[model samples]
Target: MDFDPLPDKPAPDNPSGKLVLLRHGETEWSRAGKHTGLTDVPLTPHGEELARNAGPLLSGYDFVLELCSPLERARRTAELAGLHPEIDPLLVEWDYGGYEGRTTKEIRKELGYNWTPFTHGVIRGENSPGETVEEVAGRASRVLTRVLPAMAEGDVAIVAHGHLLRILTSVFLRMAPRFGAALTLDAGSISVLAFYREEPAILTWNHGPGLPLKPSES
Candidate 1:
């Protein structure tokens, strides 16, 4: 385990830490495949159950820092998981803007093309003014800056939205923000980021409750 190194900074000689990334449980928009950002939605009953079930998987680790999005859904998930987490604005979901509350299919139908947030980005509207991938990445970087120092002390946990966490994962690996398109995080799933021989690596990803834990490779 190693703390996240700053971009353009040299790695420390000896480092030990792990980042546990948790996506908040389901909401109506999430279940309906809508782009949810800044709506302050709550978790569904099943979603709360999912988060509660995740407690066992997370209980094994003693986290030095526990952070959750300021939004209700993420905070609620953290509560259900039995973790007292500080609210972090950086953990907020990507702003979908005009696309908010709309599915990709619905967007495609309106725009007459196969559009995605990763490439096409988003547009501002009367209701929601969207954000660029770079903007979200900037927030993610700030989060890393704050969390990396804490990581030196012990494991850290983050409960947030799907798109934001994927972007954060890309930032963690020093990959281009667009690379976030390749990572898919389901609601209530967990992913672990740690060091492998001084390099960042994803130890486990998209793990849900009741799934068998595979033995780590020697």
Candidate 2:
């Protein structure tokens, strides 16, 4: 077969990147509504199944890189998702500090202050175990800035915690991280961010096993 040496092909149009953001599956803490941060817990058996199912659902994408939080839950979920992920600290969930392993209601009762990441931010003692909403947002922004360059031409999967991923989505769209408070990301759910001419667009939002895989196809 004879092939002609073609001239440069416009450098492939400077392809914009796609982000395949995946929230980790359920954990005992998650099921109990506890704030999971550095606590590092494993998924429930059902969560494991859900994570495994993600493989077939997500395998079709040509992801250039796979990243996951250093936390065990996120790491295990990434493993079950069938993607070998490179650990990135930026992908770690928000550090709940004193709130770790505790529920929102419990924290409110103890502190006498309504606490929420988007609302009150972190309440009390800020030594080293927890993170404020702004702190978490900064981490999300750092990851976003670093990953965007690598996203060109193909997709990138990031297996992480719900709160952090939500913040990341907001940051990627150039929105305030506090807006993530409005978003509800379920365990093992998948979201996608597409770029059109360097502009951010949500190709898909929170979706998972029972939902239609693609919007048009849905």
**TM, every model:** 0.91, 0.85
TM-score of 2: 0.85
The per-prediction tally of clashing pairs is 3, 1
In candidate 2, what are the lDDT values of residues 1-218, reduced to their tens digit? 01111112211344466789888887777877888777778988877876887778798899888899998888898898899989998888877766667788887898798767567765444554566677787888778666776777578899998889887887777677777888878887889887765467788888887632211100
lDDT of 2 at 70: 92
The stretch of ten residues in a row with the least summed lDDT in candidate 2 is 1-10
Model 2 alpha-carbon miss at residue 73, Å: 0.8
- The Cα RMSD in angstroms, rounded to one decimal, for candidate 2 relative to the true structure is 9.8
The best candidate by lDDT is: 1
Native-referenced Cα lDDT, model 1: 0.83
